[model samples]
Target: MPADPAVVDTDCCIVGGGPAGMMAGLLLARAGVRVVVLEKHGDFLRDFRGDTVHPSTMQAMADLGLLDDFLKLPHTEVRALSGQVGDEVVHLADFNGLKTAAPFIALMPQWDFLDFLADAARRYPTFDLRMNARAEGVIERDGRVAGVRAATPDGQMEVRARLVIAADGRRSLLRDAAGLPVEDLGAPIDVLWMRLSRRPADDPEAPLGRASAGRMFVTIPREGYYQCGYVAAKGGFEVIKAAGIEAFRRDVAQAAPMLADRVGELASFDDVHLLTVAVDRLTRWSKPGLLCIGDAAHAMSPVGGVGINLAVQDAVAAANILHDAFALDDAALDERALAVQRRRLPPTKAMQSLQVLIQNRLIGAALSGRPLKAPAVMKLFERFPRLRRIPARVLGLGFRLERVTSPDAFSG
Candidate 1:
């Protein structure tokens, strides 16, 4: 039988319907560019991922006019942040003097935030969302990306577009097809995530806390249940589970005595899930008509909790350049459009590198009970109240007063 004709053609074809892809499609579609988004998963949001939206990300949502909706969702307002240094809790409130509208971090499940973005994208007439379509490979013609080849249930098909975006995530098939280089900075620890029912009389103390020890526990407030995450060294899952449910409960109790009473409430091991934290940085973000955004470009370690926020920033930057690129009268398929990719790649790379350094080298050791300090770390909190603001900005909470061109521009 003859092959079916191209199902649909669009100006921009975005692979992956996660935050980065959806945000890019929303902006492009709103700008009147015909966009088609392909998502491998039927549903977008997955459980037990980064749920905290930094102050800067909230500001980004505000710019997109979704701030009110985002704020109205079931989330915990982290009035004060805290960290651990060998069983000692250091309140982050001291750094709250930094200049930002939402000085406090908001903890919401990542699934809800993604759902909101997808719903907003549906409002645009030019947006075409296709779920259960997995991108298998890229189609290249004359040393440039032509479009993509995706697999459907019945058969394989081709999608032709002027521009193709690989927001398919860290294990991006499109990135692999393009033969892009990926550097995986191994993670020193892994996280075991679980949800627990909050006691009716549980103390309502901001819904967020961390305990310092060989193991770390973070409790975040959800609508009805509390999202709890426990951190342990790599390859510790079997050891932890072998200790049995009672011993595991005791471990949590030792970490956060307040949550000890609630530990016994856990019904089964099925309630908990484990995730390995791996940091990755792409050697190149683009080639001709193809561009990689979000986790596809740079996957940061979960320590700073900046992955989603950085992905949002990349979407905005790409949209800005794409809008300009498509507006040109001679905007035919060529190397000229690659400029957008070039402009955004550097900052993403720099941020990812810094994340690896902080998560694996400095902060990782501290979180793991090692006693080593750099003078700069002490001065960051003591001498400069402004330095704390840098992270807020990096996480997409607010903008710096200076016209910063690079990530290093704000470093002290």
Candidate 2:
């Protein structure tokens, strides 16, 4: 017979060490709460994850007084956003006018961001991060979730906590284990991501997006390479693959001529990674002893690269609400979990709605080969520079900006 799994206990057990899980763990740990964060992966080196850290998230860092240190990490800042529609280059949004400590969107690798948060969290004596531990399911007791069952290389281990948080990505195993229902908002585009060398003579634009003919392409300038994304119809990757690598390169070149020379870099389909876009949210975000946050609660479409920011916001809200709830009994603890969903659901819905609108009207139409031009809205933004701040505020900040309300127990 197999040996029984080891058991550990904590105040809060967070599954998935992404932006949400790590941020929540850090914040709650700062409040003197015992937090055990479980990351399935041994390392945070996953590529092509959402890297846009907007001003709102930075503001939360400022609230925690970690902004100066966090900014020291290697990252690029984008002050404005624009897209090419047919023959005209339409300036979509500008972040320069936003009234915040960090107005621009900071583009850093997701792994670096997670590592920074983990490092900060580790400073708290109550924070315990266990990597290479994948959560398999929730541990139920007395008709309520009381902990997590995770698989580690050593063997199986159970973490019993006052409350359990599921921050696993869109395909969350714990959310399913909790029997939470999801409302599929649907997505119409999938993105193929690749990198191409950025030469000194290349365009210096921070991020460049293009939609015309029958394709859509975007390139975010990185330190030494351009992170490129090619958008296609939903479930259309097979068709793209069947067309062969040369045809794929031709399509990429046609979509964004700036990368025409680098198109050859994508020698085969293996060189490109496909992100199966999904827009969805859990109809009910919490059950008795468990709460769902980030992609686990709502999977976002990569429209504005807002997934990371949204997930971070969810963590902030969760920490703000639930930091002290551990002192309460089981019933009050359940209410605190529901409170996180209540406070975060509005912004989540608003962002998802905006994503769906763009996916349907813009991405879907472009993929259908509809003749494209700068939309009237884009034209207006270009015509009147001040109008750009509207999108800047919405995208660069967010609908409901969360503040770091969890008290620092270690602060003198």
Candidate 3:
């Protein structure tokens, strides 16, 4: 059947050119499916977002043959992840032994990561990259998704596809149009981020670690500089700004003294930006002929550094399932094709729930100086060698397909 006169047709039309959307497009396009990516921003790289790609994502990138390219970019390997419980710093390395080939976390700017994916997508003839295109609403027919209506500079245009993927971040226009329920797990604090010039003593190989004094602080290594972010109490940005730059510098210096020295060189407040961390989980991820990936489906809080890695995992899982369904001549345009959601939702929901429980219930109370200690829980984490392996395998990389299919299947 020919597409409507007012519509352009493709095998897959992906909304948003972020990591998940781009990855899905690349995977489908490689499988000889016609794919189009619609992005609202003219450029791919955006700032003030999650950037750490965990070991699992790195493993996925390696499978895609993009590992070397990623490593060539300015990045740091996080040898250890630490958490501050009261005045004590507990290293997480003991929780789970690093099982991934790339055991360390790669700290790179998200803009650079997206740019790399975009460049890779350009190599495939089956992929079409469309920028500055905003998806105003989805085109539905008989209670099923058919296509999307987008606003371009030229005017409104309709795009028809066998599959419509929503990867447009937390506040997705497509998800809203589909009437999906989004649950926001509010954060107790926000972050003020700044790019600090690298100190002569600073080592790109091993950047200074994250520290939390009732709030979190991290120094992520980026190209030629370091991305330093500080977690502030709710409504704390105004207080920091009102304290003046000098006072703010003093406070940062007191928290992470080494970072303070570097921050002192900052010329102005314009160098710093604020970001709010809110956890969002979608009630439904798919309907007939449509699916949502990445932040659109499940937006995890940054507490465990799982957001981007999980987004990449979602992309890989979607690609794998779609590749199989399309090959089997299954109706890729129906809810059955959304079976990937069945496979994805379980783990995504479980992890997101765990994050909320830990960050809000446990960590939140502890950060308030309440001296909330769960020694039994901590001892369990320390004693069980498998506890760390579970998270490392689950979050640091992709889900264990075989184990997820049958938990006891791995026993024999």
Best by TM-score: 2
In order of listing, the candidates' clash counts read 4, 0, 2
Query: By the lDDT metric, which is better: model 2 or model 3?
Result: 2
User: Residue 269: error of model 3 in Å?
Assistant: 3.9
lDDT of 3 at 223: 64
Over 183-273, each residue of candidate 3 has an lDDT whose tens digit, in order, gives 7766776778888776546454343444443545666666667777776776778978998998878767766656655767766788789
Q: What is the C-alpha lDDT of each candidate?
A: 0.70, 0.92, 0.71
lDDT of 1: 0.70
**What's the true lDDT of residue 190 in model 3?**
70
- lDDT per residue as tens, model 2, 200-258: 57476579888887989999988889999999888989999998999998998898887
Query: Which model is ahead, 2 or 3, in terms of TM-score?
Result: 2
Q: What ordering of candidates by TM-score runs from best to worst?
A: 2, 3, 1
What would the per-residue lDDT of candidate 1 be over residues 4-74, giving only the tens digit for each residue? 73556778899998778988887778777888999888785588877877766666666665788879988
Off by over 4 Å in 1: 1-6, 93-103, 153-155, 207-211, 327-342, 361-391, 394-412
Best by lDDT: 2
